[model samples]
Target: MSRYPDVYKSWQSNPEAFWAEAAKAVDWFKPADRVFDASQGAYGRWFAGATCNAAHNCLDRHVAAGRGQQPAIIYDSPVTGTKRALTYAELLDEVEIFAAGLASLGVSKGDRVVIYMPMVPEVAIAMLATARLGAIHSVVFGGFAANELAVRLNDAKPKVIVSASCGVEPKAIIKYKPLLDSAIAMAAHKPEHCIILQRPMERAALIDGRDLDWSALVDDMRAQGAKAACVPVAATDPLYILYTSGSTGQPKGVVRDTGGYMVALMWTMKNLYGVEPGEVFWSASDVGWVVGHSYIIYGPLLHGNTTIIYEGKPVGTPDAGAFWRVLSEYKVASFFTAPTALRAIKKEDPTGSLISNYDLSHLRTLFLAGERADPDTVTWAEHALGIPVIDHWWQTETGWAITGNPIGLGALPVKPGSSTVPMPGYDIHILSDEGHPVPQRTLGNIVVKLPLPPGCLPALWNADERFGPSYTDEFPGFYKTADAGFRNEDGYLFIMGRTDDIINVAGHRLSTGAMEEVLASHKDVAECAVIGAADALKGELPMGFVVLKAGVTREHADIEREIVALVRERIGPVAAFKTVRVVARLPKTRSGKVLRGTMKKIADGIEYQVPPTIDDPAILAEIETVLSNRPVVG
Candidate 1:
């Protein structure tokens, strides 16, 4: 009954033919000379020799197809108390005018434009407008520190910068213009011009002769009926340069091509998400991240589905009920978010009471990504919503999903911790340290056979030499995912954690994720993290940290004892999971990824730099105090 086996086989049989058939979904300006070119990029390039416009496909084609009246973007900001919808026609008009504004500033094909803004509709407009002129746009997360932004600026060397006055948070207004100015002042490369959007909450002082007002510029262009036509670019032309932080403290700008990206997104919108045109799809994420780029902006638009731009947290934009209200009001059919968001909501409500307050009949599926989705969180979400809580595996490098449950073809049986079968074009294999294929159900390194799928990053911007040493050189003829997981007999993939999370204990390799799963299953524990702490005898030993639920009044000592017993019973003593500690909160990135590596450094007593992406630096000090105050548990 499922089309997955055949579809996957079809791709495996002939990848080019499979992708060629999928390319029919998009409207290309010029047909590709080859389905794929082996001699082009690192490994290869998809849809080589083709000409296309990402913005045109995302905006103009929909407007011309009589779907202009449909809502293209619904901006929902619980923090600012603002909600507005822009139709396809209106959105297209806005983007074209903005494109013309950028053009007037001398931005042209191949020029890089750095966008530093919050979760506003203008961020999407900036990206699409840049793409409209065949320019590359790199969006830095608004919450990043000034030095981090400066690093990206130096690496990207954007010709122009687009930013806003401020970003509204739950309890405070962050003045972004100051941060943007500081970053520019710190960077070696200076942008020719800056377009600042002055919000009512905070008005920024614009630098004379170098800065332009966003409203005034765009309004003037609109008054003059200036609409920049979409420029045709080669399929291999870079659409955007998204910089992801590397372990070396240098940012790696990941390049995504236009035509191949569009094709991959279009295919996944229907097959992976199971959403149709005119329906609502909300990806509750920030525009600064890849999910926002692919889902909140491009994927839904290319599929003609209404997408929601949410500017609030999972818990405190008002309360835990915030997401449910948006889903009920917008009638969202397919919802996507990170598992950490669900964990926060579950920790707050604990009873699933907020969910029953709204009408959720229209909601069908919920997809979780961005990190490892623990079985506890998945089960909690499933029981709360009475719908499928699908945990899909992907990375920032790969724009879309590498493995997922293809609900469009037919819903596969739900496996609690496994991210169901690989989508077409991803030949996933589990390889040991020696590059030998491992046995089924044995944890090892996960890698994809090269000539990665269309939506994946081709290479790091201006770092072609580093790409090989960083990713492909470790294992020849494969793209290193850097994740350690296993494939079940049924072919489902279980992502234990990052490859580095696998610790050698007394000559046995154990997964910290597996131990964390046991810790999280305890009823009193809301969320947990497991890091391999350095041990003299065992090489490394697992240390557990957990945050308790909201209303739990139980003693921390009792709860910690129970968690240790659970892990010991489930994973056995070989895990060396003796150390356990209770913390008020886990330090996480703004995108909700727990900072486990930092915690490991603290436990090992090694000097560690505070990660720029951390949501709160103070939490790291709290973790340090907790580790220093108490001795390791038996």
Candidate 2:
């Protein structure tokens, strides 16, 4: 028997009591006056009237608990051939020193500091330091285009900008200082000071009055024995602001609160991830993403678990075995990554040969998120790793998993295409366009009930008015997930795809995700994407694009024919899945999400702006070329 039922039922019976019980694990300077006050903020506030410091909870508490010597961060950068680890005491020392450096630069409580740096230990230090001072930090992805960075700069209006001289990529060294300089020049809200970490790989020329050297400032503070004490802040205070990726103009900055976020992370570390203190947990994501914000930096540290800061790819950065090597060397207990990463590795090493090269004895569960994890990839991973391949569902707004298979409560049965049951706080519903409940196993809009659990975005940064319009107004009394899916009779969630990806063909709604799943099941197909292309008669039609596995020398035409037949047989002919194109690769975001919307626009001949988050702008041109010269097969 699983304990999940009782745990979930306990939450459903008394949500506030459930959360209040979880809050006891965290060391608070002052307890909450009320566990929850429904009349507080946009929806409601958790731990109202509480006082806490996030940095102290993540560092000082653990250090004071005698885990000071335990490794807090394991930084492994295959790209740089660099590997290092920092203990809790050492990490806290660095954060305090850096906090003093920021304090000297006039950064204090409520002030916003924008961090634009690569996946280095200093980035984590900067975030913790900002939190230590009761200030908010916004981390922009390193090496972002100048214009995109400028947009974030203008919106965030940071007082102090922390960045690096450059970021090293597999193929090239990206000079970040120049891009940072251009962004600063373009933005109307000029920051008072810019602190740049000059890497030996590429040194940057700093502006005399405006720029400061990161090492010099930290060294000066350390030499003087200067350390900033943690500043107590209200539980409702914003801890950080993370802007949604790929936003073009006037980005939506998601604000995460201090007390609620801390409590939630502590709970998730134990319950959702089944991770205990002093264990190694790796979330193979960048600091710029939500996964990094929660898992990589705060979650594991808050729970006293050693977190991995990996600066490498799933395939490159040496070879396809990079991830396995890190897992084996670090003895990672739980591993979390995006599905696209697994697909990339599976593409390069189709037989899972590279995975066998490393000893992943300590590896327990493999968690997949970011985008929908197709059944094919999930099955392949499960068979390859001999562990539960859990696919959870969430977004940047939620800041944590909405639905997941909790490893801590009790391991649940593996479901290939389902994102298990909803977590304790989330009350999921599959609703029709008219806002009525839909039947089980029927694809519909997915939404969560009001007063979303703690750790979710309280509101958009300085734009509380826009929050409702963007998220809530569409579905009254519910937070519109915008993704279409359905719940099975057994309560498992099957997220088909984004709501827009559901195409209307001859008066029938068909799922592109379902079609993609079918296409991916083909033996030769390594990965695939399905988009609803415009059709004059049917209104819309499903078009498939697939990338073949390595060493597959079969004819593209033959593989394409098989893919169409598979979809036709599985989903019936009403899917209208006719066009099949074999491409060198599918265009993806830096975070590895397929750019399906952009692909749809290109397929329909609509003008589209290149998304700032695209990994390679040249891939779009190649996709366009492939679409123009359509393969006359399927």
Candidate 3:
């Protein structure tokens, strides 16, 4: 039985007591010795003595109890249009054999294995195998360039690397093996073995000794009579070290231990997505990011739910209709995606009936993260998909959503642009620039206070001093989110945007998001990116690059006038962009955040690496052309 309490309570009044109850909610074989360990480190441990296998909790326990015949996975091919339904019995078999194959190659407990493959079934198998054997899995996004991949591989020094020959995206067929070969070629300290998947089968100039065919490798293992088994490891043993995207600089590897990650992750299942037993949930995020790690991969699976692990982009091979078709095909009860994808696809098929094309009657929740979800997207989802869009706030460092609205449980007055409330057990206080706590309604950096979150990484792996300075030491007493926000008089948390994203216009500090949301609402604009451009006098001013929908002409004067008027109507004239360049599209990452830093470099004539992450690299060139040809208007 479950004693689920009322929504808005003093969840933090007794933090340890509240967490202890949560730790018991899931299946735990051996209990933890302590619930909290302050002396251990900041954001101290919960379930400190817990010794359990994550793979068993997710797969084995349910399957061993006659639930093996149940549907465990529902996969759809990106191009072939084939459907593959995996039962728990079959999934367990795959995990077991894969674990054995890894062991055969000398990948054992405490060793690192970097997974650089697509979102195929094998990727999940590799992850489970690593977990089952007590090895730390560092799964990097397959699409990252060789430079990025090599940096992570060098950092972790994984014993093995698993990559695909090639992969797919919306606008291109990514040949990843070359990058893998290039990385291995350049590695001064490389992994002992490299396994390659043969889907979409294309090979490059091969480095024969380092790489081997993946299908041949795993197939050989299943023939070896591998059975489901979990190696006993310390509760404190690391499970994975997912590296953060290096939007600023070199990526930092985030270490998630066995006990803390599992405990914090399980709560996310029942609470965040409102994931119920046997529900079909789907989060449209890559396993590369934290959202995928928490919601898409771990949270849903932990709850014994059949979730969707999509391979292609939301807008690939088709338009916005593609997403709806999948939702209709799977009858997804919970659908999640980033705001950029929502903005992009909605323009391609704006009738919003694309949602109706599918049988979405089962859908109860639509979750959005990676970037702030605008009110228009929420209203659109409600009217179109017929589900409430629950906007949440979290970051790579935090590991899971820190501030978000729970599903139907705590409905404070619905603010159009606010995330509404801090999640239970997360203490949030707005702090001034100097780190002093600020009064309500005053915009400041949002900081998470003492009694830190367990889900939040124990520390950036091998960079404890880096964690102290970047997150903890700088602020003295709080984990400064780097995100800026303010609580209204009614206590709703309004996310103002990242402090780095703020722009100053004639001495007035303005959030680029507020301005962009108003611009995004323009009838002709499909999507727009607002970035802070270095200005001579005002320090920094807002510059926008917009992508208009089809049939919407590039009328510089008309569109510019309308946007300026829209800003005045919505906010004021001062908030208007001094420059609006109507272009084909904006540059964005795979997780769907606009690459403002890339745009900033372009604006400053500074050289930058246009990501291999975007669906179209040509769009950046289009934006550059738009900026070059535009007439200066001051």
Question: On residues 509-564, what C-alpha lDDT tens digit does candidate 3 reach at each position?
Answer: 78888887888788788788788777666676677777787667667778977787
TM-score of 1: 0.99
lDDT of 2 by residue, 1-634 (tens): 5688999999999999999999998889999999998998789999999999999999999999999999999999988999999999999999999999999999999999999999999999999999999999999999988998898888889999999999989988999999999999899999999999999999999999999999999999999999999999999999999988753567789999999999888998999899899999999999998999999999999999999998889988788888899999999999999999999999998888988889999999999999899999999998899999999999999989999999998888978999999998999888999999999999899999988999998889878889888888878889999999988889999999999899999999988888888988999889999998887778888899999998999999988888888888998988877789999999998999999999999998899999999999999999999999754332
Q: Least lDDT summed over 10 consecutive residues: which range in candidate 1?
A: 625-634
User: Candidate 1 on 74-181: residue-level lDDT in tens?
Assistant: 999998899999999999999999999999999999999999999999998999999999999999998578999999989999999999999998999999998999
- Segments in model 3 whose C-alpha atoms lie over 4 Å from true places: 1-10, 203-209, 408-413, 611-615, 629-634
Please give each candidate's TM-score.
Answer: 0.99, 0.99, 0.94
Q: How accurate is candidate 3 locally (lDDT)?
A: 0.76
Clashes of 1: 0
